[model samples]
Structure formats: structure tokens, C-alpha cells
Target chain A: MWEYLNHKNGNVLAVKNLRGKNKEEFNYSQLNKKITKASKGFFNLGLRRGEVVALISENSPRWLIADQAIMRIGAINAVRGCNSPAIEIEYIIQHSKSVGLIIESRSVWEKLSIKNQIVENLKFLIVLEDESFGDFLGWNTFLEIGNKNTSEQYEELIDKCSADDVATILYTSGTTGKPKGVPLSHANLLHQITNLACIADPKPGTSVLSVLPIWHSYERSAEYFFFSCGCSQFYTIPKFLKDDIKQIRPTVMATVPRLWEAIYDGFFGALKKMPKFKRNLIRLLIRNSSTYKKNLRKIRNIDLYETSFISKLISLFLVIKSLPLHYLASLLLWPNILKQLCGKNLKFPINGGGALPEHVDLFFESLGVNVLVGYGLTETSPVLTCRRTWCNVRGSSGQPLPFTEVKIIDENNSILKYREIGRIFVRGPQVFEGYLDNTQASLEVLSIEGWFDTGDLGFLIPNGSLVITGRAKDTIVLSSGENIEPNPLEIEILSSNFISQVQLLGQDQKNLSALIVPNMELIENKFAEKNLLEMNQDFEIKKYFKSANKLFIKK
Target chain B: MKLKNTLSQQINYLLKNRSGSRLEEQIIDLIFVEPFSLENNLLTQTLKQKRKEIEKKYDCEIKEMYKKQIKGEIII
Candidate 1:
């Protein structure tokens, strides 16, 4: 880790605490200063080296400050999500047995106060944000304390630290079950960044727009990657994805599938609302495009186009229309219709934290956006497979990062053949050492050979690209032993223009019933075109039911 | 001038001076006359409208949407 930092010395590591339109850039020197001040403040509060200090916060400048400061003091920084439910938050706090808790806001401290009844390991509360914590002191005087620290004291702390010491205890969202505390050492964090750098290859001075609720592993991984690449980071106000994208025009962005879906929905929704001629033209062009691409692929495969004039004409037309269509698509849809996709300065957009819906993957590719899907678990220091510049297999989550070895293991622990579905197991230097102090839980997932069971069912395609099938836990099983994977079905539902979200219920039931949230505008237009009433009142539900009935009957 | 007793009566009272046969047009007129009075306390109180309670109890009113079947529009 020291060697890595030494290599990246004097380079801009990260930008911190940015908001609104006025973008702020923080370099390594600036970050170093903040770390020194924070460490001095921690020392003043009687925090020693190797002590565990839990830093609970949403993404803020202070969170970064405390993160680097803990490293300076050789103390492990336990970063708990600010909005985690009391039980989950308490689990992390108690497991780490932190000497002090550095909270970002009063709201987080209040939530912790209730959980204190069950877990009493946290001794001191240091409020990073200017908020009143009940029975705890506020840190409104950070300026005075930070300013009092000398430069010599700051340098001394940095000189005394080692790379083998624990850096942070990040709690996974645990979509499967109980959230586990992943203790990442400085070496672990550095290795993950290095592995990410090998694939992402983000350039220095690249502006990154981050709004992934920074408490999550995806955002943290992205931040580390950005820092490693010497990029400037700019964050936005929560729920301001569209405006922020346009404002920052970030060279890179990291977001989830839902964000991509929202962007698609926003664009497509506006397209649906356009006058009949325009909509029909777009549909016709898009349909023709698929046929055109298929013929082009066939021509390329057979070499029939090598000498024929007709084939040369066909190739000329493809070249003429393809880039023009992309440009026109951006022009027509991106301005008002696709505002969220207008992070025009973006060179590489990393989609992770959840399954990147295949429809979304196709949509952006069609529009000429370089949307790359990556896969990982929090226990694997997050990024396992990622896309690269030279090559990409459209649907697969790219190749494994450098030396990360990925395999599919069957129920009996036998390795599966290519494209045969099974559990994904990853072994790498980037994998977390163990679940913080939970040996039983650690051993359940992590093998002695360093292979960690990702619990995600996926298969490797012939090209060595990984395609995630579904979560082993999220699979629904019926009483008669019919097992249904919901992820593919959810993806299908999400792709439908009328549908936003769908959850299938069929366990122990005769048939599946889906709970769906329909896009009101699409449904309303369909009703209007049918000379029927809108889907506003309860009585209007019958019209939709009839529509569905007709649709399925035709099928 | 007396308060309308029936929903149709009140709806007509609201729509009497409005143009167009559609409910959307009538609602537009009603809204323009009131100018989102429910958004303001003094205006709603002055109009003697218990907007929150009315909206809470009535789904259509809350959503400001009503679907009435219209024939002869579908080309098929």
C-alpha cells in the first residue's frame, strides 16, 4: 500500500464534499491536509493507534477525512451506513466494538441511541455534522480543533503507520440475509483499486459524477478507483441524477440498473408522448436497424462482400446510416427526451451494485453509449469482473479483472463446464480476509484456498465472459418442486413499456400472480387509442384486465 | 347560490361557465378558477373547501382523474 501511494504521490487522489452546480476539485495535497487535521483531532480526543473508531455517515467530505485519518492513526475505520436499520447498525457497532463513533448527522446518532439499549460497545460519539446528539457532545468546533494541529504532528502520524493494519469495516446490504461486516485492510483496499484500474483505465483529471448514496460498496469502489486514477470527484444532491449529469458532464459515472432504467423510461416516455409521425419514424428506423446489422454480420462472416459491387453498396449504406442514426438519436432524444443520458462527456459508464438489465445494456449500446456491466460481491472487495476498451461481449459482465480467478461450482462442489449454470466462486488477492470476527460465517463462504462463494448463480460463456443467471437465495421454489428464477422474469417485466416493477408470487400456489406497477402514461395512451377511458378510477381496471386478456389470448 | 347537494350538481356548477364536453376541460376550468387553492391555506379556508379531507376520502378527486368511456374513436 505504501508503495502504491508512493507511485501515485503528488497526483490528485480525490475531490471531496461537492454539491450544487459549482464543482470542487480536491487533490492529494488537499486530501492529505484534511487527513492530518482529522488525525490531530482524533488524537486530541484520546484515540490511539490500533483503536477501532466507527465512522457512521452518508457520503461527505468529513467521511473521507475520517477515512484517511483512521489510516494515519493505524486505527480501523468502521463505516456504517447512516440510514441502516437499528439492528443492522447495532450489529456492526457491537461486532467492531468501536472505542468511538464518528457520526455525520444528528439523525444517525438518534437512530443509534435507540439501539444502544441492546448494544453498548460504542463509548464516545463525535458528531461530524453540526447536529445535536442526545446525551452526546456536538462537533461544531471542528474548525478550532483542526486549525490547532501543527504540520509536524500530522507528518509524524503518517510516518508511523503500516500497510498491514485494518482500514475499514464496511457492512454489506445482505440481500440474502444478515449483513456481514467486511474488514478490509489497507492492502486489501489497495489491491481492489489496482485490480479495478486494470479494467476501468480511467484517465487523470477525468471528472466523475457520483450519486450512488455513497454508503454502498459500489460507490466506495468507484471512489477508490477514481482516486487511484487521479480523477476529480463531484457528487450531487440526492435524487438529482438528471440535473447533476448535465451539470457535471462527468467523464465517468458509476450507477445501478435502476438508474439506467429510469434514464430509459424518461427517454422512452417522452418518445411515446410525441406526435404520431415522429414516433412511427423512430420505430421504423430502429426496426430497420436490427435487420441492417444482421445482414452486415452475415456479410462479414461469409466474405461475400469482398468483391461484389452490390455488397460494397450495402456496406457503404451501413457506414453512412449507422453513425448518422446514432448522432440523430442523440440529437432527437437526448436533449429533452433523454436528459439523464446527457452526461455527454462520459467516456466510460460503469453499471453495477445490482444486475444490469439486458434491455438497458442494449438500449445504451444502440445509442452509442459505452455502458459496461461489472459484477462483484462486497466480500470480494467488490469488483470481480469488468469490461475493457478493446473487446466486450455485449451481454456478459466482461472478463475477470487481471489475476482474479472465477469459476462455477456445482452443488457437489464440482466445477461446471462452459455455459453450464452453477454458483460463482471467486479467488483473488482482492477478496476480503474474513467476515469481521465471525469465523463460522466466514468459513461458510470462504474456502482455505481463498475461493469465496459469491452465492450468485452464473455461467461462463465460451469467450470466457461471465453471465450472471440469478441469486441462489432469490430463487422461488414451489411445493411440487418447481423452481423459478425471478431475476430473468423481473428483467422481462422491467423491459415492458407498461411495466415499471414486478414481483412474482408462486411458491406453494397453483399459478403465478405478479404484483406490477404499470407506467400510467403508457396505459393511459393505450386506453385513449382504444377509444376507452383512462386507468384512473377503479372501474377503469376492467378495461386493463380486458386488454391483458386479449394480449395473452393472442399469445 | 345555495350549495349544490349532489356531485353532478356541484360538478355542473363548477363547469357551467366552462367550454368543451370533456372532464379534463371542465377540471381545467375548475382549477383555473381556483388556481390550486388547496395548495394554500388562506385560499382554501376562504373558499370554505376542506380539500384535504375531500381528497383523502375520494380517490378520483385526490388523483384529479376520472375515466369515462367515449365511443367511435378507435379506427378498428
Candidate 2:
């Protein structure tokens, strides 16, 4: 990491952090110097190699610097989400045996301090962007201490570090039980960076907008890979996501499914507010573009849509007959419109963190935005497979990355053939070493041969693309012995504009049921427009669901 | 809009169009609440629903609603 930073020329900007309406930029050399000084400071504080240092902070340029600093000194950096509860943070510190902590603010420190004491291994605390409160050391003061140590000392420490050494321990969000520490070695992370370099092929000076939580493995590894490629990254909050996208016009961005859904919702929401004529025109344009792409897919032999034989025959006839209209709509009208909406230079946006609804995938692609949906867990350096720019297939998680081996296995531990849905197990150099000091938990998922059971159910297509079905634990089993994967069903249900969130439930029951959260604003407006606002809410909801049921049955 | 009424109406609407006997028997009852969140402990940080916890919390209400439905009473 340091070598790449040092070799970069022309004072290239590495990271930019949005501050109010302004932005702060850090060049490659400046950030490299900061990492070195921070590393020296850690050494000056008598912090030794293999010691765990806790980093509790929001996503920022300094967060990456501190993470790299820890790696430089061969110490393990235990990163926890800033929004995590105080108890969970304390548990991670104690569990990982973290001797030092690098926090973002004094308020976060006070929150963690409220709990009863148990972190005996905690020797020092360094607060960034805040004044020293109590025994906490401020960021500048800590850096000043490192100024006393020579540059030679920092170089010596870096030389002693090895690729196999534990670099960071990222704690999972603990959906089921206690959050377990996933310790990723330097080699594990390096493999991802090298593999990502070839896969993403991000050119130097390419702009990447970082929005996901940096503490998470998915974002962390991607950030490292982007930085190694010499791409400049801009950090923005959710409130400014729209503004940032327009102004920065990033070439690449990473996001989650919820954000994609929100963007889709927001776009249509604005469209609904437009004048009747303009709205109808936009809708017509979208329909034309969607049809053009669908026809193009059929011509290209990538047709995944379901249609009757007669319908397909008619569509083919219509497509061949109206080639000029398709060309004009797809080439002339849609590209410029979508380019204006998502940024002029936007290549492809990567979606991870959760399953993206297939409708959302089609909606964006129809507008000429390439959406790359990926799949991985925190235990597997976060990304095992992702859709490439060239070979993107909608409704699939794309192909396994280079050097990563993915297989589907049944309950009896038998490997399944292609297109067979089973538990996904992965074996790769990018896989984490083990959970921090939790041998039993590690042994449960990881085999002696290094295959880690992802607990996610998926199948590999004959073309090597992966399609995730649902989680093994989240599957619903009916009393009639029928097992149902709810994710696909829920995703389909969520495609209804009236529905915002849903969870399917019916384990050991006769039939599957769902708990749904309706989009109240849209539903109320729809009811009002029909002069049915005075009716009971129950009746209105019934009508809305009936409409959605028709849609489901039709699909 | 009242959550319970909306939920009950939506549940009935969803079940009404189905033609199977199991479709009627499958969804026993519907209980509505505000959206789930991490603060409410109904959702995890990763945004997954905690099904076991939700079931445990609403066990009594679900059973009582089913009983009311059996008694031909409008529960919502």
C-alpha cells in the first residue's frame, strides 16, 4: 500500500471529504506521510506488533490513514461500526484484547465510557478531530509524539511486517447472536486488492464516491483497492448523495440495494410531480427504451424474460419490422437523458450489502445505467463474485472472481451440480483466517481444509455466474413439508410501488404470510387523486393490495 | 391510516383472489405495527428482519386475533 502511494506522481488527489458545502482534498504524498507519522506515533507509544488497536469512527480519509498506519506497524486494527451500541463496542474491544483505540469524536468516547470497566488491555486512546478530553490524546498531540521518532524507525517497522500477519479484525453486525470478530490477514486483503485491480480495472485519477460504512469489510477492501489503483475517492453523507453525484460525476461508485431502491423511488416520485404532458412523454420514452433493450437481448440470445410462444413470435416480428424506431429510441433519446440523470462519465455502479430486486436491476439498465450486483459476507474479505462491466447478467450475482472457488453443497455435505440451489461454500486465499479467539465459532463455519460455509444459499450457472436464492437460516418450512425461500418472493412483492418493505413468515405453518410496510405517502396521494380519501384506510389498503395481487398473478 | 386496519384489509385482499384451499389456511392472521428498525430491535444493523424475536413479541396478539377471526368477529 505504501509503495503504491510513494510511487504515484503529479501530486494526484487521493481522497476528498465533504465538509458542509466545502470539500477537503488529500493528495497521495500527503496521505502517505500521514500514515507514516501515525505509525511512528504508535511505535513511540510503545505499541508493539500483534497488539490490537480499536478504530471506532465514521468513513473518512483519516479512517483509511489510521487503518494503513496500524498495518504498517504490524498491529491488528479492530474496526467497529460507529453506529454500533456502546455494549457491542465494549464487547469488541475486550474480546479482541485491543490495547489502543482511535476514535472519531469525544462524544463517542463518552458513550463508550458510560459502561462498567472491563477493558484492562486498553492502554491509550487517540481522538481524531476533537480536543483531548480527560486521558484521551488528541490527534495532533499523538502525531507530534511521532515527530520525535526518525523516519528510519518507521521504515524499520514496515519492513518487519509480513503478508501473513493479522492486519485487521472486523466484527460482524450480529444479526442472530453475539457479534463475532472476523480477523483478515494482510495476505487475505492483498489478494482482494490484486484481484480487484484486474476485475475493476479502475484507471488512475478515476473518481470513486464512497458512501457505505467504511468499517464494514465490503467498503474497506474496495476502498483499499481503489486507493491502490490511484483513484480519487470522495466521501459524502446520504443527505448530499444527489448533489455529490451531480457535482463529482464519479466514474465509479459502490452502494447497497436500499440506496438503489431509493434512487428508483425518488426518480419516479419526481416524475409523478411533473406536468401531465411532460410526465407522459418521459413515461413513453422509458417504455420505448425498455422494449428496445428487451428486443436487443432476444436478438443477442440473452433472453431471460418469460413470454408465450405467440407473444414471443409477435414481439420478434414487431422488433424486426420497427428496427429504425428501436435504434432511434435507444441510441438518440435514452442515453443522453440517463447520462444527465446519473452523471456524464458514470461507467457502472456496483451494488452489494444485500440482494437487489430484479425489477430495480431492469429499471436502471433500461435507462442505460449498468448495475453490477455482487454477493459476499464479512467472513470472506467481503466480495467473492461481482458482475463485470463486459459480461453483466441481470438477476444473477455474476461470476466468481479470479482465485476464488465457489461450490454449492447440500445438508449432507454433498456438492451440487450447476443450477442446483444449496448452501454456498467458498475456498480462497482472500478468506479470513478465523474469528478472534473464538475457536468453536470458527470451526463451525470453516473446515480444516479452509472452505468456509457462507450460510447463504446460491447456485452457479453453467456460465460460472452465481445466483443467490436466500439464506439457509431464513428459509421458511411449512407444516406440509414444503420449503420456501422468501427472499425472491419478498423482492417480487417489493416491486409493487405501494410496498416499501416486507418480510415473509410461515415457518412450520400451512402457508406463507407476509408482514408489509406500505408506502403511505404514495398510497394516500393515490387515494386522494381518486376522491376516495374519505373512505376507511382499511378499504383503501384492500384496494391497493388487490391491484398488487393482480400484478403478481400477471407476472 | 391505522396500521391494524390496513394490515387486515391487505391480508384479506391478498387471500381473496387465490383459488387454493391451502392459500386460505396458509395465512392464519395478520398483525400490523410500525416499520421495523434497529432502535426497535425488530431489525438488525444489516437490515434483516429478526423473525424469531418478532414472533415472540407478537405471539399473544397473533393468537388472539386468530381466535377472534374464528369467532366471526371483525378483529381489525
Candidate 3:
């Protein structure tokens, strides 16, 4: 987009490279030139306005460059992370009927089942990182095509591109479904650009650490928002997140719930290596501060569940009693801990794309970290409600964005009263027009009046903050007619330190059973003294089953 | 009308190539209805189909689909 090139200070670093081999960084003006050349290159390659381009790549600066290039030429791109199953990428490319493809690398492209067939069908192919393979163009050669031949036609086309024009199609292959293309228009994305300031409100040169996959709507919109505000984004993967946090000293970060759990686990890991007295002292201070913070929140009515008047009165007394401890921890202890953990610059962190585990939310809050959680689906341009920094209510995704109306409705389509849980129906400018090609699916979710059923169950508190309960469609219905939301149960199972992942079964059966992936390292290490690893070598599963049985019963 | 038939033919070809017999995969019978509306109970306010309502409304047509399993015709 021309707007991606239009930041006030073009000299400020825009995209920092942690994934790159050389650790390159690009200023706004440099980013602008790459976009310009790439857009021209794409145009010279016969990619006309409104044509579809399948851009499959993982996290890298080139991904952003390719994306802006496609967009600037008034063409739409169907994006997916190349790490996703090759079949899924094939489905997206074929179903989207793309004219061209901008692939990540040769090694990645080799994974596609029928690469030659796909290449033969497309008008052109450009590999982002590798040498031009056979007839495919490399990133440099493609850019040179535009460099040698000057053209101002792409700029004119950008001016002609309307807000209603479909910008990108992101395939949302949710847990158990076929990939459906969600076509988001320019207007849908622009809504976030203008509106995200209400919660983020970061100054122009804010340092942002990006960890989530940018192909998803949540992270893509965040990238667009941060880019618009001229924030410097340091890109990294989950493996390097802890190191990058210290290295970048980011003032802002966007995250998902699982990453928070990992960080919390790492914190305890570091504490284990400290001197016993100092560790014990730090633990006591953490406990004191947690108690103080929770009590203060109870007084201010920022709790997950209800507390009686007497409890609130007791909380008031506890708040007063803990004042000294709170002050000691806040003034002396936490600043150092925060600096070590979040690099002394974490002003506010954002969480979206999934519900943050309650314990993780409280852990950061206790440390005086402002973790703002937002909620929406991919179809809605992914942000309907977000907790504001100034007026955050713990456990609730805060108020709706400006002009966004969120309604909790029952199966009968009647709006539920406040605090009554139901499916969330949202009507907003950010909501997409329709899914590409699949008219039946589009009609199923989006009403004629523009309301989109989010398929998520949530209730609104009196303060207009939304507390999400669970997924409405993801519920397990038993033969006995009992309904159970499996997400919370799965989360409960996942809380066991030795269990890595769990999925609840028995959708139409009498009882439930779970398929779990054990945290093998922890189990083997802890059970090593018992000769468990040596004994389990023959039938490894039996050992885990026995361990799970022992651990499950104990819990 | 021609474009609709062509689109239908394209879809039928895709289905046939994936799996199944020609008779089973081809577009033998179809109907066009107006876009689902909230005014009728066919569509929910958020536009999801009321399955029971749609079944109730089109009971005869659904029965006809079962009966027509033995035969094929192209109305166009």
C-alpha cells in the first residue's frame, strides 16, 4: 500500500530482522523503495489489478515486502504459512484460482505434491529467498525487471483502488474444517488502522516484538496497525522469544496465551537456579504482591466471579494490611524482576487470537503488567472487544470498538440479557463482506442485515465488558443430551505440568476419554531414578500410561 | 442462464473426477431459491440456516429428491 510507505519519518527503523542470517533492519524509506520496486516488478510480470496471487511464506521481512508489493499493485493475495501442510497450501492455491505464486523457498516448494503441475498452470512464479529454479524468477531478478523499466501506472492504480476492493483472502482452516477463504476488503483493515489507537496508543517510535504468524488475521491486522503507527517491529519465532525480549527491549508486544504459559514456566526455571534464601525471599514477595494486587482489584470490582459485600469489605481490610508489603515489592522488588523478564520497557502487552489462560492473565497483572485481551473471529477482521489499559477489568475482554455492536443471542436469535451467556453476534465496519466462492457458507454466518455469528459463547458484564465462556459450536453433545464445552476441560488437563496437550473425546458416547500428549522430557527426567527410561524402551507407551495413571490419580 | 449451467457443469465435473459414478456426481436435478431472508424463518438473524425450519418448509421437495434418485433430467 502507498500508505505503508507514508509514515512521517521515513528514517525510522520499520522492520527489524531477527530471522534473517545477517540480522538486517529496514527503515521506512528503504521499506518503501522495496515495496515500490516489487510492485513494479509484479506489474511487469503481467499481474494486473484485482488478480489473485497465492503468496505462501513463513515469518520473514520478505513476506511483508511481497504482501505490500501485491497490495500496491491493486492485486489480492491468498496467504498461508509455508510450514502448514503442503496439501492445505495446494488447496488454497487451487481453490483461490491464483494467477501467480510468490513462494518462500525451493526446499519449501519441493514439499508440494504436484509442484510441476501447479507451476505449469500459473502465469509466473517468484521464490522469495532462493535462486530462480528452472523457469521461476528469483526475488532479485523479479525486482530488477521493475528497476530497469520505469512505470508510474501502478501508482495510478493504487489511487483507483477503492476501500471496498478485496485486499487479501486468508484461509481459516479452523480445528476441524475445510479451509474457507475469508476475503477482507481494504475498508475492513483500515478500520483497525484508525481504531486500534484506543487501546495501544503507542507513540510513533514504539518498539514492538512480533511473535505470532502474520498470515492469520489477528497478527496480520496487528502488523498493519503497528506499521501504520510507525512502530519498529522486531520479528522472531517462539524459540527465540525469550532472547529477543532482552535483546529488543520492546516497549510493546502482541502475544497468544500459550506463549505466556511458556514464559511463566521459564520464570520458575530461572528461580530454581537462584540461591535458596534469595529465591524464597523473591517467592514471598511475589505472593505478597499477588495477594495485594488481587485484593485491590476486588475493591475496584475487577474480578472473574462475583464476591459478596462482606468479602469485598474483608478485601478492603486485606488491602490496607498488605499495603506495606505491596509497596516494598512494587518499589524495590518487581521493577528489577520486570526488567529482567520483559526488558525494562514493557509498557503494555496485548493478547488475542485465543482466550488467555486465567492464571497467566493474573500472573502478569500481579506483576503490574497491563495485559490487554481482545476477542473476535477471523471473519470479523478479528477485533470486536479489547481490554483498555486505562480501564481494564480482569477476566473480561473489554468494551467494543467504536461503532462495533456486540450482541449475545440465543439459538432463537433473541438477544440475551446482560450476563446471560449466548453466541456472540457482531455488526461492525470491520466485519468482512463474505467468504470467497463458498456462498452457502458465507450466507450461513452472515445475515442480510450485516450481522456475523462469531460461533463463540460469551456473556456481557454490567460494565459492557465481554467475558467469553466457550465455543458454542465446539461443544460436545452426549447421547444422554448433556452438553459439555471441552475447551475448559482440556485447559484443566493441560495444567498438569507433565501433560503437554490433551483432546477430550466421547462426543456422542456415554462418557469422556482424552487423548493426551505427555511432556516426555519432564516425565523421563523426574522418573529417571526409578529406571523408568531403561524399562520403557521396549513398549514406551505402557510407561506413559502407568505414569499418567499414577499422576492423574494423585492430582 | 447459460453461465449458471456452465458453472454447474464445471462443479459436476470436479465432483465426478474426485470420486463416484457419473450418474451420482452429475447435476441431474437442482432448484434456485431466493437468497435466504430473516423475514422468513428460513434464515436466522445472523443468517445461519434453521435446519428444522428449512426441512419443514421444503418437505415435499426433499421427498421428491428421494423419488428422483432413479431418474435424471436437465430442465435447462
Candidate 4:
């Protein structure tokens, strides 16, 4: 919480004013005053210690202020995803039992903008930027009340908060129904941020450009991680990722694999329209560069910063000229590449949120940017495992962070041996307090032994590496009663440039059928390159089916 | 490409004009688009695309393609 304030105080937090292309930067002192006001305001709004206040806003400085202010009041803040549908939004407000809501009125929240009508328990609606809270007391009035409160009163409430006091309730994107609110405490969050900071090791003044919505745990932990390291953080309101990145030239960032995949697909799609020889040459360069880097990683690992003089001289020569060839490739490809996915010179790109394709990780790793693949849920304070540049593992989620323990358990509650696939349970300092208001659900996942059942199936490698196969809930059972891991096959199909999305369908069928989304541009460009323009219709499906027929084993 | 109003429209336009034959007129077994999300699949399934929906949904991929083109790829 203090780190967030520090980030703002330092004049480095770029709140992309979506009203126009113009962005406003905040210094530590200016931001802290607002945070302190926000804290006082929320307290004056009758927010008591242990009460919950729901925050509904897009990415903005006010959002952070409202969030941290609730923490300062010893009240838990429940954050809803900005893109949440109305029904889901209402469900969150009800489930969280939020006494009040802090909202920023815009086209996005206009549908749910009815004050007090949607949330019966809601007492006040504090508008952040505008006086659009019709027939309601505005945030400015609340600010005045907070200003009137003695500093001693504010400090008393803040000092009452212990590490165990719930800080926030983050609702997971429930693919099925009403989202589950994961309740994390101050200690849970700080511990996770500490581990993440250790893993990424961002330098002081490291600039981080965040694309993933701060509503998500991945970005939330990352925001704090950057803060703890004294790094600068910048974000645009709503969505201005592309413009923000070029302007920021961020030293570190975190994103899901889809962003990286889009960059890869866009590059190849454009290349397909190039002259055949030129296209082939670029592909050759990518392959050669990957191979060369793979060898360099091996050489570096062997020497351990003690390279022989001869090898060092060879490296000097390579750096002087030949190595710059790939550097130029990065320079040429990265700008357009960043423009494609709206990212830039991110020093370290951490991947989480879902299972990431190894090929996707390697593609960026090949580009000389260290890509760290991590694993966690909102319940684990969000970060459990993260890879470093030197000891990176492509497919696995890397080793558990310091002070985190992992165990695989069988049906009898027996711990499985290493390299054996079983249910994954994690014990760590940062595990969440529990799901908000869902005592039954919380009991089911969290055991008395402090192991949180991750509901993910995987095994630790013989060398103690975590390999997540698939969600236990997503496992497909065959007629022979054998459970099949669908992720491996689905991941392979997803790796194909032709297939965009894949979901395996078969509860009892002889074999699985997939709902596949084809990359039309890639297929269309391929058709154009192959002189098969006349067959553009159904070309993507045909090519994919043809490729699948050759590779997939027939049942 | 701006001559076309929508991405699916541009795609159909390309298919119709490519090789001087209207491929859209042909009875095709299936139409495929790389589906990144459930929303993408829904949009592709809708035979006619709304300019706003297509533009908002596929903005990232489309802009990425445009950037690649800017870097000198000849789109057939």
C-alpha cells in the first residue's frame, strides 16, 4: 500500500487521461495528498473497520486511491473487473455486501449507473471525476468530511489493521456464473509481492508498462512488485497500451500469452505477403537466431561468469558486428511488433493467468527479452512460481518462490512421489484468508493443514520443477474410465497458426471434437502466397483439417 | 482496404475479387477464422459483420496486420 503511494509521490505514475491523448503524471507528494483525502473521505462515509466497500472504475489514479483508502480505514475493498457484464456486476455488489460503492461514471458503467437502485445495501455513491451522481451526495462532500476528521482518528483506525486484516476481495473471472471473491489480507499480498520482487528483481527506477487490467491478480501483484522495487509504473485509462509503451519504453512488464501470440502471428502474417525468397530468409534468420541463443545460454551456464579469455574475445568480435545483426532484427521487428500488440522494450515479460504455450515463451526468449512463466491463483496471493532469465524453464512454471511449498496428493490424501501426476496443493505464507462470505466454498479448498487445493493436476519434475498439465475440472474421462489431459493436445492445436481457439468436446464420444477458430489472415496470406486465392473460402479450415489429419492419431 | 466497410466485408470483398472469381458465390463446406476468444467465434459465425463490432473485437489483430504491412509486406 505504501509502495503504491510512493509510486504516485515520485511523479512516475502515468494515468492515461482517456479524455484525450494527453496523460497526467503524478509525483509522490501530490498523489499522497489525494490518497490521504480518499482515506479520510471513505472513513467519514461511515466505513468501519472490517466493513467492505466495493470499487467500480476503469484504470485511473482515483481507482488506486479509493482502493488504498479503504485499506487505510481497515475496511476491505472489493474490486470488480471493469468489463464485467451488468448481471455479474450486480452479483458482485450483492455478494460483497458492500456498504458503499466508489464509481467513475462513463459509457462503460452507464448501464449500471443507477444509484442505490441496483445495490439495496449501498448507502453512498461517491463519484470520482464528475458530478454525474444525480440526486446523490458526491465524493467532494465526503472529502470535506474526511478533511474535518482529526488526523488522530484516522491514524487510530489505520493502526488497528494487522497483517491478517482482509485488504481486498478480488473476484475471479468466473467462466460459469457469479464470480468468486478471493479475500486476500495485507500480509498475503505483501508476501506474494516480496516473492515476485525477488523473482523478477526489477532495478530501482525500472519502468513497468501494465497491459493486463489492474483488476486481475497478475497485474495487481505486479503493480506492487514494481512499487516495492522503487520502479516507476504507468497506465492509460481504459485502453491506450500501444501509445503508452512507446512513450514509456518500459524496462519490465507482465502479460498473458495471447498478447505475445498475437505479436508472433501478426509478424508471420505480414511476412507471408512478402516475396517468397525474402519471407524464407526472415524465417531462416529467426531459426538461426534461436539456435544461436540456445547455444549461448548453454555456454553462459557452463562458465558461470568466468568465461575464458579466448571465448570472451570471440564474444567481443560477435558483439562488435555479427551480433548486431540480430539486434537490428529486434529493432526492426520490435517496433512493429510492439505496435501490433501495443507493447514495447519490456525488459522482462512475466506470463501467467492461464497455461502459456512453450513455443510462445521461447519465441520472445529468442528475441533477447527474458520471459518468465509463473503460476498461481487469486487464492495463493496470486504468485507461487516464477522463472528467472538464467534458470528459465520453457514449459514448466519454474520453481516455487521462496517460503512456498508444493505437494501432490492422491485420492487417499497421500502425498505422491516426485514426477507423479496428482492433485497440486500449495502451502505458503501468502495463501489467502478465505473466499469472502463463502464459508463453505472456502472450507472445501483450504485444509486445516494450510494446504490450498489448487484443483490443478500436475507433477513436480524429478529435479523439483512444477509442470501444470491442466485444470482438474477440465480433465476428460474416456469410456475406459481413463482421465485424459486435454491441455497438452489443445495446446498443440493452439500452437498451429491456422487454429485460433480450441475447446475439446467429448463427455462420452469415441473421440474428442474441437471447436476451432481459424486465423483467417494467416490462412488468407498463405492462400495468396501459394497462388490459391480462388479457394479463399474454407481455405483455413481445409488447411487445418489437412494438417491435423497428417499429425493427429486416428482413434 | 478502407474501401470496404468491415473486416468480414473486406474479407468477403477479397474473396469475391481474388483471381477474378467470386469465391463467396461458391457453396463452401465451412468458413474458418482464427478464434482467439468465444466472442471472436460468435462474430465469425454471424455471416454479416457490423462495422463497430468487428472493428472493436478484431482491432488488435487488424492493427497488428497493418503494422506488419507498414514494415513492407505485399498483401496480395
Best by TM-score: 3
From the highest TM-score down, the ranking of the candidates is 3, 2, 4, 1
lDDT ranking from best candidate downward: 3, 2, 4, 1
- Top model number, DockQ: 2
The TM-score obtained for chain B of candidate 4 when compared with the true chain B: 0.36
In order, what lDDT does every prediction score?
A: 0.61, 0.74, 0.74, 0.63
Q: Model 4: per-residue lDDT, tens digit, A174-290? A: 533356889888898889776776667876667777666777777888887776676766775324555566677777878766556656666677778889998887786676556
* Model 3 C-alpha lDDT per residue in residues A1-555, reported as the tens digit of each score: 444445585888889879754366888889888888888888888898899999998767888988988887789999987676666788888888899998888877887787877877788998888879877798889888878674677667778888888989998753222478999998999998789889887777789999888888888888888888888889898788888899899988877766676677678778878999999998887777778888888888767667789999999998898889879788887888888787888986888766666667777887889799888778878888999987788889898998899899998989899889898989999999888899999999999999998877899987788988766575553322233455544454455555554444433333344433455566555565554333323234345445756766675
lDDT of 1 by residue, A7-126 (tens): 575465467556632234556766666666777877766676778887777776667767777777777877766665555666666667788877777676566445555335555567
**C-alpha DockQ for predicted model 4:** 0.07
lDDT of 2 by residue, A1-555 (tens): 665666864387899998422245788888888887887888888777899998999887777777888888899999975666676777787888888988888777777753336435567888877878777898789889878856565577777889999989988755222578999998989888888764577788899988878887888888988888889999998778888888889888888776776677677777878899989987876766667666665554444434566766777876675566656766777676655566767785888877676667778877778888787878889889998777776778888888999989998989998778899999998898788788998998899898998887888777688888766677564433233455545555565566677766765344456666777766665565554433366566657556646755665
Cα displacement (angstroms), candidate 1, residue A273, comes to 2.2
Question: How displaced is residue A485 in candidate 1, in Å?
Answer: 15
Per model, how many backbone clashes are there? 0, 1, 0, 9
lDDT of 1 by residue, B2-72 (tens): 11111122233323322211121111111111222346442255654342233334434323421111111
Residue pairs in steric clash, candidate 1? none
Model 4 clash pairs are A9-A27, A9-A28, A10-A28, A11-A26, A11-A27, A517-B35, A518-B33, A518-B34, A519-B34
In order, what DockQ does each candidate have? 0.02, 0.09, 0.01, 0.07
- Stretches off by above 4 angstroms in model 1 are A1-28, A113-123, A131-140, A146-160, A174-178, A289-340, A475-555, B1-76
